[model samples]
Target: MLHNKVEEVKSREDLIKFLLHLRKDLQTKGNAWENITLKDYLEAMEAWVEDMDGYYLNTNQPIPKQPSWKTIADILYAATMYE
Candidate 1:
């Protein structure tokens, strides 16, 4: 399932996982962590679903903008589905 690779997102663990990834990226690339706040991830997830090609094909149908954390969780989850 796409959601499985998102790690244990219990009690905001999702956000923590995101932060840890951000930290690692910083340490490796020496670039400041991109501000992937909950709001930003929500927007990115909407974009990912509406367009981007991953394991699933999201319809081009338009959906209301929302800041649901699952929006991104689903995208990250879906990407690893086929891996």
Candidate 2:
């Protein structure tokens, strides 16, 4: 999946480009390019937290709670598309 590639990205610019490409790919799959709202961003963050919790509970090893600086930059770049 594209998400797998995304997780492996270490460079900020590369991650931003990948995320933008991902959005376009989704659009090709019938996902609209509507403005992503704050609610949408929050929901995504919440889902990530839940995923981390589940992984921790199953493996007994905590997944990294803090994303890398590059990842945070990527998130901010993605947020620019929001309404």
Candidate 3:
């Protein structure tokens, strides 16, 4: 059910780096997240979840199409941690 491809990460460091940037992006955006556009939302979500590519990152599971409404809500829930 993994959404992401089977491509192995280049290294754990990369994963760590990706997560750091993701956290930073969310942190900087802060309350400004609401003003972001759909395209920006996609980009932010992708980067946060390792560029999801074709799947959701949280569970590393493939989504039927993009993601569900709950999915977005969950993302925001977790993302709020950056605040």
Q: Count the backbone clashes (under 3 Å) in each candidate.
A: 0, 0, 3
| Model 2 misplacement above 4 A | 31-42, 56-62, 69-83
Give the winner by lDDT.
Answer: 2
Deviation of model 3 at 62, angstroms: 12
Provide TM-scores for the models: 0.32, 0.48, 0.29
For model 1, the run of ten residues with the poorest summed lDDT: 74-83
For candidate 1, what is the TM-score?
0.32
Model 2 residue 30 distance off true place after TM-score fit, in angstroms: 3.7
Candidate no. 3 TM-score: 0.29
When superposed on Cα atoms, how far off is each prediction in RMSD?
8.2, 6.0, 11.5
Worst ten in a row by lDDT for model 3 = 1-10
Q: Estimate, for each residue in 24-51, the C-alpha lDDT of model 1 and write its tens digit.
A: 6545753332323556545655566665
1 against 3, candidate with superior TM-score: 1
* lDDT tens per residue, model 2, 1-83: 45455556678777777777666655674245333555776565555445545644675754556876445543443443333
Higher-scoring candidate on lDDT, 1 or 3: 1
Instruction: Please give the distance, in angstroms, between residue 25's alpha carbon in candidate 3 and its true position after superposition.
Output: 0.9
Show pairs that collide, candidate 2: none
TM-score for candidate 2, please give it.
Answer: 0.48
